[model samples]
Target: MTSSDTYQGLAVTTPVSLMFGRFSDAATPLLYARTLKELLAQSGLQKDDVDGLAVSSFSLDPDPAIALSRSLGLSLRWFQDVNLGGASGGIALNRAARAVAAGDADIVACIAADNNLETGFQDLVRDFSVASRDGVYPYGAGGPTSVFALLTKQYMQETGATREDFAALCAGQRENAKTVPHAVFNEPLSPEEYLASRMIAEPLCLYDCVMPVSGAEAFLVMSEERAQALGLSYARVLSSIEAHNTHGDEASPLSGGWATGRDRLFANAGLGPDDIDIIQTYDDYPAVSILQLEELGFLPSGKGASQLATSTHWQQKHNTSGGQLSCGQAGAAGGYLGLVEAIRQLTGQAGAWQRANVRHALVSGYGMVVYDRCLATCATILAAQESL
Candidate 1:
């Protein structure tokens, strides 16, 4: 019930200024699409090669299809605007796969963009408070950090976890980020250093949080039949699920909604956790992501923190790309940054951070309900080839 038709080839493209970390004195800024046409034109596809446009993002002022339409001078047969929080990106990829199979459109594009952190640091932190739902905003400021703080506190109380234990997660993920070229935070971390880091919330330190970064990534999606015709090497979209925990007060009881979402999606795909080689977890904070993994069945519900700090998990390639904490966050597009990394790992192109012989990738998008702290979540498993 959760699986769908597969896609042929998937390719990633980004705007020029966003590609290199050398311009602006190697500074990264929010990507502007003025140069996207050139990069896209160089994609080797004919001008009319694309017929479908699917964009999942939070920060692109003008949606991508409309922008790409004027820039590339093409009309589209299908257009999708996915506004879900974290899970929005992967959900779009799943929809594109189904559309390709249904003959809705070929050469569909799944796009997620990131922007520079320098220009918007203050704006972002302040806006975090405004992100609360109307109902919860009155009682207390229910932003990402506050809600996760409450959740992290509960996880700690239940699991006998300590801030030092959580620090293990910060230290480990930072090490993972150091191996990733595009990672903004390439610095190595230590548990002691993690303990010393300034606390933004009660338990989460500065390094425990995901930074705001400017950039964008894209995937060219098509049917397997179309892929054979084009001769491209890419992955297929296997399964996807999106569930809204619109009521976070209720989410407190489950406390494992994200993992439940992943289980549901993979069940639909007819596979279990063992089939996945890598995963990109939605992480605004390191602990939330770590907890999400356990809920995802990689570890027991309350065992996320323990596994997060283990050297074996890294060697096993579970959360390989350092997660959003080390990379950078761009609202909804943050998940795609993780997806792009997963795609790279699967395609043997992850460069320095490539996991050894990766194949299946399960990506989880955990989003703030826009109503409460992580009110909804979505997960998708992508494969290099047909598995069944």
Candidate 2:
């Protein structure tokens, strides 16, 4: 077996920032610039040090990653435009790690940002998928809420999950949001409130869906030695996996591609589900979060809703940053939320809501819900440098 140590040598270190909530003046490029500026400032690195870049954005149309490099005055040796929606962050991390390990770049900045102006979200939803525009939207299917509501209903029927189960998860995340400085929804949420909230789609109350806002998230990937030399604390990527168009035959997806490579992911990390100390899932919807937990082995298949309702484990440290549901999904930046939050928790930088003695974090992403199911899925296992 190839030694996991070789892969673990690559690390994601300091200079992580998440800007949440609405930004009317800012466009996508401005949001990207803001995150890049903070990343450079925090890492104490000059723009010249960023030899590689990876960008993810929904509204950065007519401009690709290469275009942003020039706009930002960055002459890069490597660049990538990740458009995988929520999975983009994981893929970016995986790519950046490989780039640094292969000597393609010494330092890489992975960023996802976007501005959600008036009508911006409606436009995105209208053109999100061919199936949506051609088939679903015409019938007023109500975009992702409708799509996910169908999935949630199926999941509940199969697993005997009640609306309260979903409400509990949303309420718990809202409680966690209370400590995050940038979270958009800081109000205490009770299960009663969640249950009483207006229903956007059947079985999916207003609180069950994520609020779209404008923001950005960013992080740096480089050699562990480079991070240490910079006096930065870092998180090591124990293992990562990505898959596309998984389980395509299913009418609606109850599981994601994370399960396809989950065994390999754990094997490469030399760890298992029980070893994880924290979890961050791409929570565009509460039901999606539950599905990711099941696919990633944190909860048993078909048991996520029941476990979430009954278990105290999820209430404590999962989605410690309140997730996008509370922080507001900032277009493509939603993909990086969990990854950035996991890095924070693992590096002991998650102030206020930081869990004690966090050594391992499991982060997962699911995106590109075009037709009947999400086409992209990815997961990562991050460990504290000391644990490595």
Question: Highest TM-score: which candidate?
Answer: 2
What TM-score would every model get versus the actual structure? Answer: 0.83, 0.97
Candidate 1 segments whose C-alpha is farther than 4 A from its true place: 1-43, 61-68, 114-143, 246-256, 259-264, 331-333, 386-388
Off by more than 4 A, model 2: 1-6, 331-333
Q: CA lDDT of 256 in candidate 1?
A: 41
lDDT (Cα atoms) of all candidates against the true structure: 0.62, 0.85
- Say which candidate scores most in lDDT: 2
lDDT of 1 at 102: 69
Give model 1's TM-score versus the native structure.
0.83
Tell me how candidate 1 scores on lDDT. 0.62
Candidate 2 colliding pairs: none
lDDT of 1 by residue, 330-383 (tens): 535375666666766766666777787666888877765444456567777777
